[model samples]
Target chain A: MPIRYPNGQPYSRSPKQGQAKKPLPADTYSGRGMTLEQDIDEANLYYLSQQRAVVHKKPTPVQIVKVDYPKRSAAVIREAYFKQASTTDYNGVYRGAYIDFEAKETKNKTSFPLKNIHPHQVDHMREVSKHGGICFVLIRFFQSAEVFLLDAKHLIDYYDNQDVRKSIKKTEIERLGHQVKTGLHPPIDYLRTLDAVYFNGDAKERT
Target chain B: MPIRYPNGQPYSRSPKQGQAKKPLPADTYSGRGMTLEQDIDEANLYYLSQQRAVVHKKPTPVQIVKVDYPKRSAAVIREAYFKQASTTDYNGVYRGAYIDFEAKETKNKTSFPLKNIHPHQVDHMREVSKHGGICFVLIRFFQSAEVFLLDAKHLIDYYDNQDVRKSIKKTEIERLGHQVKTGLHPPIDYLRTLDAVYFNGDAKERT
Candidate 1:
């Protein structure tokens, strides 16, 4: 069998690496630090190299309306608009299980606000899970550099009971979620916990 | 359930309509032209409103390195890099099943060229099928305006045999594919086919 690359692709990584190295970010984002997006991107690389599982963050969807071609080599977007996404931030296949998730980082140390997640995404995860897909969210507290993977079931439960509150408490997240320690390559190996949870049926072990 | 806007968000359609009217073609590259993406976008709106299922096009992922805050109202991306996406162009849940596929339009009249598709997408769809997800591609011949849904199983088969010949014959796609007739509300009612294939157990219909 041919080796499947991340995203179920079979291209040489060197090309992708070359594309990734093209002076986009000096160090992942506007100098505050590596944004949560960057951290998970590197983590995806690590997971790919070790053949852990294939997961990726979907790119920010920007609507490019006008492009100026001073030269055919360069396509500069002149007039474009940003669109809101309907699904989660990340989703991919892992160990023959469809794994979908959204990653959010909050500044508030006490709790992660539900506003960070859109309701359409909440509906999406619910539908995915109803169909037997494994869905969750990877929450990071950037100030603390702590990561937690909260299952979608918990999220839906919280979302359904909106009459209660506006946020998911950090303490509750810590208790109900699995912690993902950041690493060098594939910085966020949240799938390790996914395997132990969904596939292995030890999802309750996190509690 | 609260009403979801066109992009699957639980919001009013006012913002999206205002955004879509901005006349930027960057977001219009779904290759359907202004009317096409709008049709599908509208179709998605109808589907969501009716509670059929949730589906959406994956956003184009970009790595932003430098962003300039010219004003408190808007932030401009000064420099950014394109990232490789690891999944298909579209994915979502329908009637309790995971649906993933890429949409492609070809000008060629004789054959649907495999080159129009990336290897990574093939890998992603294969993985999606492996995980019990519903996977397929929506192929349209703009000259004829004929839309067909070809199962990923058949697509991967033809893709794997690419060494022999590098194209999917029109006859082949027609023989193995299911045609999607355009409809009101959401222009492309492919979800009807999805319900037929996934929930009603119509896989044998194509076979």
Candidate 2:
């Protein structure tokens, strides 16, 4: 029988329970069990440890409704619901420039669907770009285990132009976006691409 | 009689339930019902509307342990716990520069206690500053309704110096930090203070 919570409702374990318990292999580049979010988190940690950049993934937004404060214990969140995020998932400072981006992984092989990104997120990326911040989207093709860093300008143009196709073709992405190489130290080394595209291959020169 | 949740646990209202329902006064400078967080949020909204800056408060972090997915409805988080934030509460981009800060309100009349800021936060701020982000803390004296923007450098200096006092004296804060004036539009005009100190009173010039 399924476990029941205090209110008589059945309690269910998270879908990722089995995967979370599984031990990671010695090599992550194989990218078998690791998710794109986890890869980026590991990269961010690596960046922070080296004092290279200060990027972080924002916490998941939740609308907390009820909390229980028991004696001699931490407050327990009894009831809550997830809320849509207003901004991108990741942001940070890189070489005195404000960096912001969203990461998404798709199983499709030929193209990246536009449905993965929301309208508000496009507007936010546009606004961040207008304010002179380095804004982009990191798209990973799960089938090929490849990642690409596409600047927000290209994304905003496609999002705003009604005549264009709904999804961006893999060929077009190759032409417009820079490919991010995976490595052991930092799973996704997108900063190397950023250095070439935005900072003229030398971050110190811009600052 | 109190309401009972599905698990037979009694549901108690949040501590801020009463204040959440109260209407705000027309004049916020009086700050009768407004919290420091609320005032900064209002200011951030104002900044976003004007296309001046893109600052935001990171959402509260929560660890969801159990969730109930009722068919055709949003998933309800039944069991969770609040997690401590790893970084400062607020951060954003302004005039092509990275900005980061934390806000705190003190009811004390003479001094702002140092215990309010955690050691890890100081370390995080130090890391941010080293990475070239404009970092600071917003200290508000609840009794006086006055707010000050203290640079992270000053706070770091005091924190690292073991011989110094435990709290920052109001007079010392007045000497080192710039006073943030309250205005009708943004409520707390911290950007103006930033303009004077960091941007030489002209944000465009720095950009």
Candidate 3:
């Protein structure tokens, strides 16, 4: 028996799954164990503390139906439902640029499924990019602990042409996206990749 | 009997409340009746439709505690609590600039109380401003049907020096902030106010 994605595609293990790898330092933050959201949150906190960026994850949107206010106690939500977000998960200002992105992790090792990216999110990324915001997606391969910063334009292109292929092959992602380095201090240093891709590696030009 | 705020401040009517006012045209959108948040949402929608800007009100932050997954239905959240937001209510991008703001309204005609703002929000705005994002507060005076866009710096200054005055006088807001014009299509034309204040009345400089 093999695990399968919601779309019925069979999951396969990565070729390097059993290969020996270099061990991470004892002090490495998160140590490739935290979820992508947690890693990004840690990085964002570090960024804020250093005054390098002002990014934040939008709170989980919930459709609250009922709440009870008890005497001398805080209101407790009695009924609610999770609501799909209208925009990306993370956004903020960095170096006078509006930065927007969604972070997602895929257990599939061969390719990243298109089903993980919603239509509204693609529309949002397109709109943000059109408005001159730096838009991208942070994709993490859970099994291999590899993260890539794929520009929104590339994802949008592949998403719009999904009839040809329902998923983006790992090779295509490696070719088009910048690999994010994981280390201590701030687990995923995507900003360094952003500097290389968007700002032409010159961070002080705007300053 | 006068209405009172949550802080127990006695609210008073504006001096011109009883004066005869000019009648507005029947086509004015929202007609100064909607809440500040509604007006901003409407304006943001219009801006998006017109490709003028991309702004959105972040959803209310909720802490979801328990969820039940039924056999053939959407998951229902059974226990949750509303959480105070660490940042402002609204943020977006416009004209290659990161825009962040909080919208607040008060029925009191004389002053806008500092107590309406939270310290964490002030800290967030300060961080945003430090990162070169345009940060401000949209204040609405319900009694006068007036909306003013006050730069975050002004509010932060008064907030930090709160020992002198617990509230900012309406006159001070008028002196330091730009009055947002109300009209159809978009109920609040705040981007126009932003143009005058932050962009020096030039909308084409960046383009």
Candidate 4:
């Protein structure tokens, strides 16, 4: 008998069990009505409240081209465009280590396209890695509701090798990435995997 | 002889050199035409361009209430209100260490009012300190044109002891704070002081 959680569902040890974990429409990462980014944002709030980490999604920078100060009313931004972010979406201090990452959800069942990540983002991640910051991607496969935390090095390797291949096959991610176990409290408990990927160092590098 | 850069007047050696270094109207932290926050923002941009650090001021979080999408023009945010930041204004990784701080300038010559900082900011800084991240306040005395990087502990002490005292005196700041030397390039070269307060430990702590 598989171990069951408080919700009475068996621990999802594989993709087959993923559905049992997410019964509601909102629980699905790519349910069209929901998003993986929302799940990560909620998890960040939980971590913040517990004082476990200070991670936050940077606000979308906007370039205000025009504004109007209406009489007796708040100033209205009449026109604006989103500016590209210089760094990853989320970053903060975790147990004295700098944590930084971008989160993306793909509905594809077979592979994650490199196009989902901008070239500048890949460059930014590579630059962050050189600065000794722990950088990774929180990639969720919508088809399986399975999430994986893949180190920036792995992403960069494939990004640079894009001339050879346009997309990273699911098999490579399974081999190179750390599966992030989800929970009811903090839907994405990624930091636990951080300890394994970062501190353990060279041992994991072999894989 | 005043020690200056290759360009001119010797770099004044005294911590008092801080005042002389800031000569331009914009250089003055309290100049009616400019501000200390602007200097930090510019310095941050320089740091980014140089890849010296990955620091950035969090965009002022705005609660966008209404927006209009013009047929051919950019989206217009018709209604929005600034949201209170749960954390400080600036935060990011610097040399593998998490650096977080709030920059404030005061025109009052004798004392920097505690009211300039919010209680929530105090609480957030305290929490950040507990997590081993380097936290501080970049306070500028507009009259003297001197900037100091005071550790969060010093600020917290004054914040929690507010019942006993109202504000931090300039004399106390000069005594307890790390005087940051301003430069023509970075304008406020605070990381120099950061090394003293955070890494050297013994050096600026005695201030």
Candidate 5:
């Protein structure tokens, strides 16, 4: 017996046999089948435990239509549909500034495609920046094992200039985005880089 | 055949026949079956469409231990457990200020029970206020057909002095909390009430 996906293809777990389940890269996505989102989640947990920062990833929204009750167990959701989020994935107060951002991954080596992001998310990031929140996008080039934090403003600018190009060039991203140093406890140390961007030297001034 | 709930009682649908499905009152959970959260959700949608404010309720988090992919359609969440949220139910930017808060309803006429709120929510709201964000709670008295927006600061003061009393007196809440005027387009016009609390006279100055 095989499990079929929505598109009528079999879902497999063979690391060597399938394109979808390709062997995990040791340096990317935690290499143990952990997603980048999972890595950031663990990092958020670390941030909470240490009281270094406060952030949380919004849960995947599901529209539940029907639920079933068993004899002596919890109610089970029998019918539900995935809903598109209207806001960014992660947001919370950091130090004294509001932080909001989205995380995305790309296998493309030359550029980060804009299609990876929805128009709603881009619009949301812009809205966040307009209202004084520290907004950004965490982009991971999985093939190269590189991650960068690109300011939401910069992304919006590129989006508005789509008449010129639909994707952000690798050179532009390298020059504009801040490289996120990987850490042990919390996989991505993006905040260490953010303090330099938002706080500058004043970070030391705060308790 | 009857569907039995976890409590060993049969689920019922009629007001006369069933214990669980008794029709609610107009002011009480909309007896038409609309929960307070649903009203707030409609209000939020109105706010978004009007471009008046950007607020969103975080999704209920679920820890998916297992998933089953059926042959015909989307994957089913076969075995999952509800996860406790770290932050409040709602938080977002409004007129250049970050807004964070929780919504709760009680049947009590004289006092809103402190037990309805968790310690973590109080801590989160306090942190948000310390960082310059606006924080408060929207308390609805279903029996009284009244809703009040109480500042988180006042709530915290009462909470910290729990040795004296476990609940804040109705008089204290009525004296401190702003009465939210109901509106047509956005059911509960809490933001209008917020403008008075947070923006005050400065709201006219902001574009």
Candidate 6:
């Protein structure tokens, strides 16, 4: 299907349904055709065209060790390694405020494991917030296909007491988060929720 | 040889140097075993670890068509196409101010070609500056092993009259930018220039 925004600009889309199915693994999002990366990318494009806010996922860090150059056309990275990131996945400017966030998905339905998040990520989010930025997490429960926007301050609070509480219950997330229904063009449009919960309220209290 | 910082932190020499050289096409940094991507990555890490600033290369936008996962542990991207980016390469926060920039290198020693930078990148830099963020380009003339910090406003001015002015000459950049000497550890520490230019300037003129 041709995806066109309200402004008449042709929008880009990932491979649909069976076109990308060359699957060998069950849990890999890439095997499922449209990875979360693609969805978020499309979401950013939609946000940009509409002048909503600027958000982007930082690239995965890779440490390269060896390269073999016989012919100078396509350099092949012979040896490389992945490095863990200390910050959240997504960040940008929204309505004159800096926005920072991490995104995650879990197959389990019982609860969202805080273990999936790193302490360094918590520290990074805290730093962003301390510098006066909007920070949060976009969590998706795969089975239910339900997405939630949880504030970073809340996540930081739980993280500080995580040793005692163990994990954040799914029920608690459902209670605190603003539910985001996935859309067609931009599959995950969570910024709309930000407008209501953060902007509509008193700015001083939210900040 | 081992590298050490002034602060006594043991430093790993350029990870790019460790990679085996591969045959890549002419005008491709990848042919030498290191691409533009790796240089920016190293720069970002250096900026972060030193508490200087947070800057990262935006991910290479890819349109993934097919993926093959041979195992549950790894997902192989079988077929993907590159997409043009809408914004500059790097952006982040530093010392209570937002930072945005693009890094480009040219093999040409005489002049930096205008084609190396995209129009949207210039537009994005303009918007970033209007938003009160520090923005610029980190240009490296690889042949001469020299890097220069050209402010975004200067670039935008030239970019606007590109039809008449054509490319930006090296002498012009030399006159406009502060030269950055590459070191063993972080390689390019341009933050010190920023400290002297933006942060340490008279307080009232800032912002």
Instruction: Report the C-alpha lDDT of model 1 over B1-207, residue by residue, as the tens digit.
Output: 898656564543343353422222221134345445555667776876777756666666665444445432334454444455667877766654567788877777867888777788898776667666678998877677777889999999989999988889888999888888875556788987776665575566322
True-contact fraction per candidate equals 0.20, 0.64, 0.64, 0.39, 0.21, 0.21
| Residue A201 displacement in candidate 4 (angstroms) | 7.2
Q: Which one wins by TM-score: 4 or 6?
A: 4
Candidate 4: which stretches are off by over 4 Å?
A1-33, A66-76, A201-207, B1-34, B201-207
Q: What is the lDDT of candidate 6?
A: 0.69
**Over 4 Å off, model 6:** A1-42, A58-87, A105-110, A115-133, A141-147, A160-166, A174-189, A192-207, B1-40, B61-66, B71-73, B78-86, B123-133, B143-145, B180-186, B200-207
Report residue A108 deviation for candidate 3 (angstroms).
1.2
**TM-score of the second chain for every model:** 0.79, 0.82, 0.81, 0.80, 0.80, 0.77
Q: Quote model 3's iRMS.
A: 13.4
Error of 6 at B80 (Å): 4.5
TM-score of every candidate's chain A: 0.78, 0.82, 0.81, 0.81, 0.80, 0.80
lDDT of 2: 0.81
The ten-residue window of minimal lDDT in model 4 chain A covers A19-28
Over 4 Å off, model 2: A1-32, A201-207, B1-32, B201-207
Candidate 3 per-residue lDDT, tens place, B1-207, comes to 779756665554332342212222132223455766777899999999999998988988766666777555457676666777899989999987899999888777899988888899999998998888899999888888899999998999999999999989999999988899987878999999888877885632222
Give one digit per residue, the lDDT tens place, for model 1 in A65-176.
4444543233434434455677787776565456688877877778877877787889778766765667888888866888898999888888887689888898899888
Error of 4 at B71 (Å): 3.7
Evaluated against the true chain A, what TM-score does chain A of model 4 have?
0.81
Q: List the candidates' TM-scores in order.
A: 0.71, 0.84, 0.82, 0.79, 0.77, 0.67
Best by DockQ: 2
Q: Clashes in model 4: which pairs? A: B3-B10, B3-B11, B4-B10, B4-B11, B175-B207
Residues B21-137, candidate 4, lDDT per residue (tens digit)?
112223224546557877898888887788888777887665555566656544545445445677788987777788889998877798888888888889888878877788899
Consecutive 10-residue window with the lowest summed lDDT within model 5 chain A: A15-24
Per-model DockQ: 0.18, 0.41, 0.27, 0.18, 0.16, 0.21
